[model samples]
Target: MSGSFGGQSAGGAKKARIEIIPLIDVIFFLLATFVLFTLSLDKIQSVPVDLPQATPAARPITEDDLVVLQISEPGTAYWNRELISSTEIPRRLLDYKATVPAPRVLVSGDDKARYGDAVLALDEVRKAGITVSIETAFRATGR
Candidate 1:
């Protein structure tokens, strides 16, 4: 039998080999899929609507037209220097908007004031459709 156990020819067994082309193709396919998925994450989903066109106003606004809305430490709201209750904010804003051609508000709060009060004032100002700005002064709190 010449040491052939199965009575077959003496051809050696084929060595195991990794096919590089198919491996590379699979890796490139996964990379392309991952890149496309990541790119899609940045898309914003929103409802499309037709917006109104803005017409430029002939008159320009001045510093005197600026309104200051201040919130104090006790959560009290002051409009330009006058103390006003929270319920009065919306009405006052609407009245001011009606009277001024271009309405703008400056929202400020005391260093220790309740943040909710300031946010409420800002929300009312926004509901009134007026432009608003926040005060950014740094004051040292005497601890």
Candidate 2:
């Protein structure tokens, strides 16, 4: 009766076996749940713009023929993430209009930005002579 060292259960050789079916089932369940949870979510892609809210209406019709013009609070302007002088916008828009047909433009001005700065950006767009849409956030009213 060697206590535990040589003690063998009355059954034959006890081989340590790792059961993996339960682990696989749990992994699959978690993966499936995560995918299903995010499947119904709408993707809202945009540059960070602290835009003033307005009535829910038409949104920017983003497409391949689109140019995003952003004006920051410091009066700095960007063209699709590329820093560009406000003076450069007109030239660039003219160049694009020459190569492309009917390019759409979206102008986004920060809420804290100077009113003159927003007007200046819009003015540049106007000078370019391309149809421009002012981008704004949707403020829901009465639920």
Highest lDDT among the candidates is held by which one? 1
Question: What is candidate 1's lDDT per residue for 104-130, written digit by digit as tens?
Answer: 998887676688888888898999999
Q: Which candidate is the best by TM-score?
A: 1
CA error at residue 104 for candidate 2, angstroms: 1.2
Report how far residue 141 has shifted in candidate 1, in Å: 13
- Clash count list over all predictions: 0, 0
lDDT of 2 by residue, 99-136 (tens): 76777787876554567877877887788788889978
Model 2 lDDT at residue 124: 72
Assess candidate 2 and give its lDDT. Answer: 0.72
Error of 1 at 21 (Å): 48
TM-score per model over all chains: 0.53, 0.48
Query: Candidate 1, which ten residues in sequence have the lowest lDDT sum?
Result: 1-10
